[model samples]
Target: MGAAWLGRRLDRTIHAISYDSPEDPLGRRVVVRAIERITGQPRLQRIYEAYLAARRDGDNLWQMAAEYLNLTVRYDPAALAAIPRTGPLIVVANHPYGAPDGIALGYITSQVRSDFKVMAHAVLERAEALRPYLIPINFDPTAEALRANIEAKRAALAHLAEGGAIIIYPGGGVSTAPHVFGRATDLPWKRFVGRLITTTHATVVPIFFEGQASWVFHLVSRFSETLRQAMLMREVAARIGAEITAHIGAPIPFSDLTSWTDRQALLDYLRSTVYGLDPAPQRRAA
Candidate 1:
């Protein structure tokens, strides 16, 4: 195995040891106190306390999942500020690095907008660490679970109706392509993002992350992608060594969504407008 892989194994072992020990009450207390001192924000401190309480209340699984991943976010403040200040915006981005990406984006959006909430997977919603900011949009694995899926969608729509800022990964869970950067071809099929924007009259902010997680993590990421066909396992891979760098593109106004029937046209418009691409020549239908 490579040195990086070995290092990752060591890190996981350390975390497992620390986490599995049931007699570390004092140690846990000290760590929590240290976090409180470092953050110095009463609200955030309260959230941390709630996380501990939730963990003790049989929510340890989600806490462990969150700790096993890491995130590194980068965005231009000037560019972010230039975007129009519209209430109830839907922030959409390519799915990269699984839950860590959501947590990082959640934290950043929480900092930028007081009413920020994420339309996240139900598994992610189970996380005590992220529950404060995430609003679960459950995705059922069975074709027979369409009703449940519709309920989740309705809840998301209601949240937007309430003037809440939402973060959505339109590609769902399949867009976290491992290895390489700037491979735009890997993006998944566009879905209800445009319709959601059009119906809700919410502005769409397209974001791009320029970097992905470490290669070792990518190995495991691909494994999970194949075995479970879900990207949840990327969180485990990230604990070893995986980082992400984000780029926040400009926002698109809701009024410019006339060609709702044309998927490629809508996608191209989003890419060009948000990522600052020169307009492509209109394609004739083959």
Candidate 2:
């Protein structure tokens, strides 16, 4: 009965992620289903009751996120200490696991500094759990969406100006299945990170978090991009107890970025820097 109720909303969810993952409670259905697949319906219900009780008792969304992560994620922190607790900063990373990675970033950043935000795809802005940490960018290309994006940019700049830190995924979309000649990879990053560096002169950090969704998640993309994202929604929760490796690179100053005249070269440099933390995810056969 729960699956039946969630089925249509999940279906609608797929269509939405071809563009960006929607911030919908419907998305919660996918994660809940994943948890139920392992813990059974009764236990899942108990977990929800606990969460609702927490809400009633005045627990914040971030605390709820930590509770969820305690059950599912295990990541090592390496060199994360190199990041300064107080400063204007920009951390750029590859969007390998989409939503979960954002949560990981938020959790890690909050550990270092309370005054920080992530520049995220606008759809993620809808998640009440992530609201305090997100500066959402809508990629719809429609005028309204573009306007929303502009506002997001303004906010990001203001945060940077205030000496707060921010995180950004250069790849606008989640990493797609590897191209014919490449391993699973993100689309090219926008020049926005470079622009941000130039504009704010914020310290930039490149982070590489190891791991990806299962092959099952990648296979779902063969049918539709949205479905792939939806499947990832489920897969992410099922990753409980999984080990995640996080490699943090030394920070780079804005003056260093200013010398690079070639946009492609700059992106390649950033991409290679991230891949440097570990071997790049193996590319598919050409």
Candidate 3:
């Protein structure tokens, strides 16, 4: 990958390393390399290598990601069975552990419906293996990101119109600690998800991933969004061999969603409904 690509994807200043320059003044290369090492980028790179290796061995990205972490997922059987076998379906979930939750939902839903796509961060599209399954949305603030997002929305709408399923985490970003010592909760969700539901008349199924990333992640997130993004892969690596519990809620038909005139209000209700499935006692208060 090019230096610009690395800088964008990894959220580190990789461009500081002047590969073509014979005399590197300002020691910027040293500072950037130190930042990468401190953020565990080398270890994350190794993990990405294993992920690509899995693809070479004929595994899909979701399956490979789950296997790399040895992640075991348990879903509510009754709720899972409630999903309509054929129709436009939207699987909404709380954003807890970033890749783990997305990969888990993708792996589980794929078993039920082969024609499904996930609305995911554009950075994941770099995997190449995941492009078929991902409808990428660039979260970065580049001039091109808005255009890409609009195209992604059009693609998602078309996919649903064709009676395909979609998986989305309404919270545009990961859950974070409300305060220094508070429980983690999702950032305010966007209204576009509700609009999508209304437009497609898709059946809404909620999934609650039962845990958050390491406390250190939440703490780091309180400081810088860029640093938080850089830390995500390392957090995933920390959960190697972890058993992840995901709770599926009863499917809310489009009929039930019609009462709310305001899409943002509807989105809020859906957010609360998903969080309601969290087993943690004080989650509602958060």
Candidate 4:
């Protein structure tokens, strides 16, 4: 029963990626399969299977994703405990590893509050298992991203206004080289995060993931952005059974951010604050 449900969901996700249309030719379908095959479609199916099993057994989805990926997430219990239990809250983090970091966030924060939602890439919305937790933003430049993001933006604000929590990756894109000299660091964070912080008066909790993807991952990234995205699952496969460390900084109250009048300045400060959580410089060394 679970396998059947998972297959249907995967089909829907793939068709969505294909942008299903009657005029879509056989070549386009071939391209979709080729891309999917390269992007660890089989491995992702296994992960999704595990997720469905967890849902069936009434277990946590985040925990299932972590375990299936062989990721052992460790964070300071006191830091997590310090999160504001009730009120409008925005958890900002660096996007180092593509999917793992998001899963780690869900696992970490779900322990504190169940009312939080994550702002994620729009493709993830196709996963029925993940829909409840994600507020998707279309990052495709070809699409009308500003218009596409409006609904998600409104949903985030409404959630915060109701005293719910939301998580955001201010960098907007994953960290990589060339974009930040020789190092792997988040791309210049978007100013929208600052706007959300100020607008909702939400307490901001900055969290940093401790490592980067393998050298091969970054090397391929230098060639093509699309190729880099396709290699995300390969990165996950490489890190299987790896201990993923997360550092959670003290929460910054909205009052603390009010003084920063400039949008870029506010985003720069918040980026620094999150990156500051890294305990060692060598961990991110290229």
Candidate 5:
């Protein structure tokens, strides 16, 4: 049965039993006993309660993070206002910083539309603390837990299919690098996002963030690169101060010509747009 259906049935059954005649203390006791029996474990009731509480906590943290970041989103107000009503826009942005970037973008999207989701990394998803607010994308091939990742990806696709907006960091984990500090040279363009937009026929909105993290974090990033394990770099970057200002570009319509070549062209277009907006560096690289 579907989760929504099961939840409805559970709610209806509980309400029916609890409200039945109101005077029968025996009926209320029976309802409690039924719940214990249905759950099949004495500990399950506590677990369920704890899970709900954790979900609320996760949501609260997400809200607080959004407030803390306070991203100055520079876009045409008319365009921003049109996005929620337009349905299922694919928000593409340059990944800067580790924690605040996604949080700020997600918050901005939420302000525009209620039906929005974020495609986050598997590590963040695995934290039971954050799982309630994050839909983890499993990129690992060796683990059997990837089934959840598959389900999450399907959920994202279904949300888009139903005309819901989604925020994705196409640069993946590398954008979280600390050394990226307003530097124009390190941006790595990945092709998966282009494929997603073309396959889903969603309009692409490019966003750019104009800052990065501290040098200590960059040292950790360098260490990870040397060890050939870059995933941990995001966590390192998050530890230090990483602030960014986000800028949204004009939307690109999906079409038949959005092949790999087209994807590269789009990436180039976005890169050039961001590069042009970046201030002239105080000093040129040696």
Candidate 6:
């Protein structure tokens, strides 16, 4: 049920992120056809319906995501406990695993901090179960999308200013080019984190959990991005006892980044800090 719903929403919002305009009906249909061909609408519907039923019966989305993906989530309680429980907190993480990553991240954080909300794309933001925990963001660059962005910014800033904890996937979209950084890495970290910190003076906590998408997901990216995303369930279903790990680092106060002159530099610094926790070459390969 949930899958069917989010799938439809993704079809509609494709233009919101892509070059096409939301008002163009023709563009919408094209996007749907392209994606459906890749994901197979019939299979997508069956998977979503079953997932939705399970989701409705439980308050734990993390477990649902893990079970659906066939993954075993593992995190260090001591590492999570090491985070300072003071001031407004902002978690900056790599957007590798896309949807499942958010669920696991939210689940881990909620265990330590209850006042948690994620800055998510408009699609995930629409999930009724996740509505309470999401601050919706439109990826379009239109005047309307710009207005929507401003509102999202306002809401996120307000939430932080109020000492609430929020999680942000700075990469915005999931990682596409695997060879860009010698491994799968996000496109580019958005400057929103810098802006958020400057305004709210929130403590930025960086964590790294490599994306677990299958090679097929990455290989197919060479063709169509829309179809690649539409077929994420194939990646999800590949995880059987696969371990998802997160390494949390100490907080970096907003003031600490004041000396970083360039905006992109700051974003890079944050991305590297998170990537710093990535498993060393041998371990990752082994």
Count clashing residue pairs per candidate: 0, 4, 0, 0, 0, 3
Tell me the tens digit of each residue's lDDT in model 6 across 1-286: 8656755665565521122223334444466446554444444345556777766553566666566656666777788887656569999888666766776788778777777788887755434566888888887557987898889889999988888998999888766655423357777778877888777878888988865566666777767665565555445444445777787877888779888877778888888888887767542321
Which is superior by lDDT, 2 or 4?
4
The best-first sequence of candidates by TM-score reads: 4, 3, 6, 2, 1, 5
Candidate 1 residue lDDT tens string, 102-188: 655665565466666676665454334567666665454566356656776676677778877788877666344335342232245
Candidate 5 residue pairs in clash (backbone atoms < 3 Å): none
Q: Which model is ahead, 2 or 5, in terms of TM-score?
A: 2
Please report, in order, the local distance difference test score of every candidate based on alpha carbons: 0.53, 0.65, 0.75, 0.78, 0.54, 0.69
User: How high is the lDDT of residue 48 in model 6?
Assistant: 50
Task: For each candidate, give its TM-score against the true structure.
Answer: 0.61, 0.75, 0.84, 0.85, 0.61, 0.78
Q: Per-residue lDDT for 1-286 in model 5, tens only? A: 5655645555454431121211224433344445334432233324334544555432544444443334344444665665535666788766656555666677666666666677777656433444645666765454555687667767877777888777887666544343435342334766656666666788777666666555444565565432212222333334323445566566666653355367777666655554444444552220
What are the clashing pairs of model 3?
none
Q: Residue by residue across 178-240, what tens digits does model 4's lDDT show?
A: 642356888788787878888899999999998787777788788765556656666656666
Q: What is the lDDT, from 0 to 100, of the residue 256 in candidate 5?
A: 34
Number of the predicted model whose TM-score against the real structure is largest = 4
What is residue 276's positional error in candidate 6, in angstroms?
0.6
Query: Cα deviation in Å at residue 285, candidate 4?
Result: 11
3 or 6, which is superior by lDDT?
3
Best lDDT goes to which candidate?
A: 4
Query: Which residues of candidate 2, in runs, are more than 4 Å off?
Result: 1-52, 55-64, 71-78, 179-182, 279-286
Please provide, for model 2 over 1-286, each residue's C-alpha lDDT reduced to its tens digit, 9 standing for 90 to 100: 7766667656664422122233335555465445434533333334445665567544445546556545343444556777888889988877777666766666666667778887877655444445777888876657888888888889988999999998888887667666322355667888777777777879888877776666766776666644554465455555544555567788888778877777667777888787676644453211
